[model samples]
Target: MSTVVAVLGATGGVGQHVCSAFRASGDRVLGIARRPSAAGSALRLDLAEAAPAQLAAALTAHRTEIVVNATGGWVLSAEAMHLAHVQIVERLVAASTLMPDPPRIVHIGTIHEYGPVPAGTLIDESRRPEPQTGYARTKLAGSQALLNATAAGTARGVVLRAVNVCGPGTTSASFLGAVLDRIRDVRPGDRVPMTIADARRDYLDVRDLTDAVVRAARAPESTVGQVINVGRGEAVAMRQLVDWLLAAAGLPPDTIDEQGAAVQSKGGDWTRADNRRAARLLGWQPRTALDASLRDMWHDAARRYSEA
Candidate 1:
């Protein structure tokens, strides 16, 4: 009895990995993206622009039991953010109503939606969101939509507000991803220029994050309407992460051009997830060691470089 799952943003950084994980689990997985299908059972339907009827038709066609909203991205514009995070989600809520038995929507939200937490605070599901960035504000709005729908009995879902994600498929759009893009090509003594942000944040392996997504999909109805925090549960210095990456790449600590670094922080920014509820509910916790994550990421980057 395989579950029918549809992953939006199937071709994206995190979405592709989510698709792979679900497929490997022997589920009936449909990879939905705006572009042509490349390697899986993908359907190209831009939910950002599609009507609820359109999305409902696709879900009905696939007999979708779970709809994973992996489509929200890091774009920083009012219209783009609204389309990806708010408008599209509103449509998904409406679309779920149109289903014979509405599917559970596992939305991939951001921990940034918690907005600025105290420098040493651990973020739990109880923190009131005061999202400042356009990305965070829109993502919060999107999560709220699903929550409201779930409360009203019009939808069933879980929102996994994820921390900073790392591991394979790290894109240049992110800080760690930016460093990885340059680290793979650097020799033992070659220098790489980067501006490491002054922040201490929790980082989660993408595979681990996907594992949580799968859990949310399979979780019982009791888990619906819950906003779960998924992460390593500890915030490490951003500069320390860069050091680990360089070490994994077999480069010297001096390989980083520290002169270009952002000004030092005096306990300026931080966030760590209190994953207790997640453990109690989903029986989920990150299993990958941070060092192992960095090492594997380095290997994947080198492998891609070789293939290229």
Candidate 2:
């Protein structure tokens, strides 16, 4: 059946692709943003201050079947993390619940919701969340909200806890983008202070992540209350990814070296997602490889930089 899907945060890194993926899958996408854009039929809505009635009015015009809460800031901002998390997810959930025969809600949370796990262990939904940062803490709360919504029969919901998603359009201004830009600009033998060895991060291609969302949103109602991890089941070290990027750019392996940094700078280690549930339940897998995808993203960013 043809579906109408609403995309909150429709202009951010993952949200941009989420919009494209829905359009590609033949879903009519109504994109919502704090600042409206031409990406789709824009809806002006600010989750933070919008009243419950206002939020319901925003969704009343469209008979949406799927609602994707792609809104949320990645880098820590001035706003309280929990407040930001609750505002976006809550607004959408509230709107969906208000609608008669509400649509299936898809909440885009982060893998950080699982907190810091040791390398080599499979990070799955069954594990209890032990959030280390305020961001993760808020995301965990969002996950709970979805579960609560499902249990209360307010709406059918699914929460996707995603990992580090890499793709084009990232700049030095962004978290990973800054590191990538710095590495690309550095000359051979210029050692930069890095915490690559400290953390094992799970990086997913934005394209592949979008595919998982599209699949999960269309899943059966029986799959409600499921918390899924959408990622490539590969636990790649930060140092390894940096090396891979250097190799892709034809830079020598030792061209960039990690300055023996302090404990806090090194950050936490990571593990890959156990996508068995996503595969069986959502029938999804990442199609893009890290090295090639990074190269493509770098070139695209470089082109954009030159154009600017």
* RMSD from true fold, candidate 2: 2.4
* Worst 10-residue lDDT window, candidate 1: 259-268
* Candidate 1 lDDT by residue in tens digits, 1-308: 99889998888888988889988999988988888466464788877779999999999988999999998776756898899999989999999999898999999998888888888899999998898778888889999999999999999989999998889877677777778887776777687766777779899999999999999898988999999999999999988999988889888888988755455321236879999999999999999988788888888888888988
- Encode model 2's per-residue lDDT on 1-308: one tens digit a residue: 66888887887777788999889888788888788876563787777778756766666677777888887765465365666787567666676677776778888888887777776778888898888877777878877887787889887899888887777754354446766777767776676666445677788878888888899898887778898998898888777777777776667777765677654311247768888898989989889999877887778777876887
Best by lDDT: 1
What candidate 2 gets wrong by more than 4 Å, as runs, is: 171-175, 184-197, 263-267
- The C-alpha TM-scores of every prediction are 0.95, 0.91
**Clash pairs detected, candidate 2:** none
What lDDT does the true structure give each of the candidates? 0.87, 0.76
